[model samples]
Target: MATKKLRRSAMLGRVVAATATLGLVAGLAACGSDSTSSNPTTDSPTASDISGELNILVSSADASDKAFGEVVDAFNAKYPNAKATLNSVPNDTYPTTKSAQLTAGKVDIFVVKTFREMPDYAVDSTSEDVQLAQSGGLLDLTDEAFMKNYTPSVLDSQAIGGRQFAVPTGNSYVTGLYYNKKIFADNGIEAPTTWTELQSAVSTLEGAGVTAFGIGGKDTWPAGLVMNGVVGGLYPTAADKQALTDSLWDQSASLDSGVPLEVLQKTQWVFDHAQKNFSGAGYDDMPAAFANGDFAILPDGTWNQPTIDTAVAGAFEYGYIPFPASDNAADNKYLNGKIELQLGVSAATKNKDAALAFLDLFSSKDVYTKFVATSGFSSAQPDIEQSEFLNSITDITSQFEPVWESIWIANANAGDAAAYPFNYPALKPLGSDDAAAAAAAANSAWTAAF
Candidate 1:
């Protein structure tokens, strides 16, 4: 899992234009309502019994992963009428393995990670295994009640062409920056409010023989995050942010808008100036280096807070700030994130009520509180009181709420066929040159393609 924060200011407002360009496809829109009829009459005799077993599958590194066995035990304790067996697979093979099980009719529930590079946009985009699963009459979870608890963005992801399919699990996976407070204090650097100051700060750190920015070009997603968030950071106005987000979703909204170009330039500049081997560094490597003080600054998200907090053991001092961009004080902005992981009920499960009940269990105050406290992640449900860690994330997210609403929320390009975003990595290269004409041409090609 990625453990890095985006620049706090730009974190909320910033729209990841690059991710739009990447062309990574995942499942789409949720629609239709749950049927009131109990099991179609044609499908054998309906069982009156509500008690049955459901198989739940998820990607690796989940907080409840190692302890999921215990969570299942706890669940069984509370609901003796229902039982769920847990199955976890390493991220790399999850798509195929899970698909096979679903096709073979061996699994009942599925949990997918949205930010994973090759996201499963739909059950069957490129993989035959996924196709097999879809061919087996898997249920689409449009009408499940658990969906009522989700925020709009989470709901949007599940609705493909107005049809609901998946339920978003974790809250939006945020991206931002983390800086060593000691480095800023020792160098007499106030957190840079504008791009110019940001550049100067990095220069000072470099001159001091300290790596100023931890650039992880090797991990394409984080690198792309910096590039996209830059667009939001530099253009603080809601209208401008919205324009960018709109452009990403609706390519015709604008052409070669200056903000995206600026963002791309900033990313390239950081990559060019940062550690020599940054291009080869992975996401974990960059944060590990930052935690060790190998680098004074890192562009990441709240997800990494747990690891950093653990690594420093409270000895390392750090602070959250927006990603730097060339903007006046009035233009300085914060980008808010939506959710990182998504959860949904199985469409094909014979035990629809049981599945919904399980999801409801996951969303309960008790489970939510425990999950957020232990995971250092925020809750998507409005009812839950955010944990201390999530509270900090909320505070930061609140600062850029306007940007998020304008750019990310309103201007989402997720379903825009023309945007052609396959994944963040693929999109980053398209914007790499940072040339105005190049961007324009890219946008034009995108518009033409879809």
Candidate 2:
């Protein structure tokens, strides 16, 4: 049972990470009497005026509890009168536990993955931060001084109708193709810049009897990484991608359309060429496999970097790049980027002053920087210097185009289809015809939902 629980936690973490990397729903327009239009600067209380026991809820899988524990300790030192406790829950139970706590008014603050997942706790509440502000379930922080420390664009992304409900923490670049430097060099293969080139490289590696790519297909979410990586490059622009999602939601888009079909085809290609028995492999197996030089590439996000490094003990070099999804260099240049985690205050907390103070401290330049740097995630605060691991991927990530997830995918009533394209199951067979049929079935389901 212990091993089973651990496996479930790992799977939950991968699913959450994948959603952070690939799932995005259009922001709902803010509505309700509680909407924050202007900065409520004067309403915020000073640190000394606040005092109470503050409880924070976060996932245990990513070492988030330890990182936030350090911040909580620092916060207590500044406001010695107030006490803060970190409640680290297993990733598999976080959402349900958070929801129960929120409904019971027992949680003072909580970690939010994306606005998209919030509605499950409060039916009338929308995932958009602004809508959340209007729902009266979250405290308005627009006027807070600490908010000014972040890049305006970063804060803006979390806003709904111009009211910020959450503070963005880490910048997540999902859908990266992490390659073994030594393996590629030994094969005389340069990083591919086009789909054709990528295919050629895969063939070359396969001919030499080396696994070209490593996948944890049994986990399901890892398989979707290929689809997410391809979709961004296929559309390559916010406007183009938005239009496609809109069409999809309205039943006007077809599975055979240029971008959708291509995404399905590429996903099938990857599955067909992955390491032996990939369908039975687990997520925890990939990093060790790649680190041991058993596979030339692993399709995943920066979240895996720490695990990969630990697995190899830094014995060989590895690098990341956006998956080259198209032959057109211009079209295949985007990365799927989003905030991996966020922090927000509960409106139901009796200790509102203490909650605000704690949030302020968490967002302070000193605390925020230390947390992000130590966690090895890219910072949302412009002034916080990113870790060396993040800096290494900046050249490719800097050129990222908007991913479709953040533009027009519907939440609220759309269910799982809102988070990921359901057609991915079809690609498990790794056949082009099977992929095409699955895409069509997914399109039909989406159309019915919309």
Instruction: Tell me the spans in candidate 1 whose CA falls farther than 4 Å from its real position.
Output: 2-50, 62-64, 97-105, 112-165, 172-174, 203-210, 219-221, 234-257, 280-282, 326-338, 374-376, 382-388, 398-450
Provide the overall lDDT of each model, using Cα atoms, as 2-decimal numbers.
0.54, 0.67
Which segments of candidate 2 are over 4 A away from where they belong?
1-49, 91-106, 113-131, 207-209, 237-239, 348-350, 398-419, 428-433, 447-450
Tens-digit lDDT track for model 2 on 1-450? 001111223334544543442211112122112442324444445557767898888877555566788888987887777888889899778877876676566777888754643223222323333334555657777877778877675665566557777877667767689998888888888988788899999988988888898888886667777777788777776567766765665567766556787788788888888887787788888888888888899998777788888987878888887888888876766566666568877666667667777777777777887888776667776646676778776665554343445554443344332235536755654323466777776666555654
Put down candidate 1 lDDT per residue, 1-450, tens digits, no spaces.
443323323222233422331222222111212432223212211224346887888777757574445556656666677778888888778766765664455666676432211123221212222221232233444555555666554455334435444555555444467889898888888888788898888888888888887766775556756654565566654456545555555455543565555554566677666676666787767657887888887877666777767776676678776676655744544544555445544444566666655665665567756665555556655556765555655544544233232134321222231131212233334234444544555466545544
Report model 2's TM-score to 2 decimal places: 0.79
Single out the weakest 10-residue window by summed lDDT for candidate 1: 23-32
